[model samples]
Target: MKIDWAALGSVFGISLLITVALVALFTLGIVGLSRRERAAAQGDTAAVAVTGAYACFAACAAAVGYGIYLIVA
Candidate 1:
């Protein structure tokens, strides 16, 4: 039996980076929402926060969809 150490390591590294990035994005989205709640009392800032949060969420969804597509196709 033969093992491809290099390819295995590459896959592991890529997966780790992607997982970390997604987590960071999600965390940012949560933080943005929290900010929005606080900023609501101050006006326009809440709108910016809401927009940023939604953008982060959208990127996360896109990443998940792309991962699913890669697995299925």
Candidate 2:
């Protein structure tokens, strides 16, 4: 069977895009967590909690996106 270079290229491109997106999202989560920790150390409970929640949400969103990418790709 002949190799389909075009199809391979498309898959590679999509995979790269997904990987970059995931990395960005994970980075956001890490940043959020760092901010939360700093706030907690500063005695701002409310701000710390909010930042923690946002980080959790970001992580969840990244996981969902990865699952969808795997399914479609």
Candidate 3:
């Protein structure tokens, strides 16, 4: 059997890109939470930061769910 090198490379590249993007999204969420905590300690409210962090987390969850659905179906 012959290996389809081009198809294999394409899949590898897309997987790597998605992995990096997901990690970055999760990292931003963590940073946002830290910023919110810091602001609260200084007697200030960082509503935007908290909201953005939750949004990031939601996006990550959605992506993961979609991937699972694809595999199961």
> What is candidate 2's CA lDDT for residue 55?
70
* Model 2 weakest 10-residue run by lDDT: 44-53
Quote the lDDT for 18 in model 2. 71
Supply every candidate's count of residue pairs whose N, Cα or C atoms clash at under 3 angstroms. Answer: 0, 0, 0
Can you list the residue pairs that collide in candidate 2? none
Q: How does each model score on TM-score?
A: 0.91, 0.65, 0.97
Find the 10 residues in a row with the least total lDDT in model 1: 40-49
lDDT of 1 at 40: 75
By TM-score, how accurate is candidate 3?
0.97
Over 1-73, each residue of candidate 1 has an lDDT whose tens digit, in order, gives 9999999999999999999999999999999999987877667467777888999999999999999999999
Off by over 4 Å in 3: none
lDDT at residue 70 of model 2 (Cα atoms) = 77
Report the lDDT tens digits of candidate 3 across residue range 1-73: 9999999999999999999999999999999999999999999999999999999999999999999999999
Q: Is candidate 1 or candidate 3 better by lDDT?
A: 3
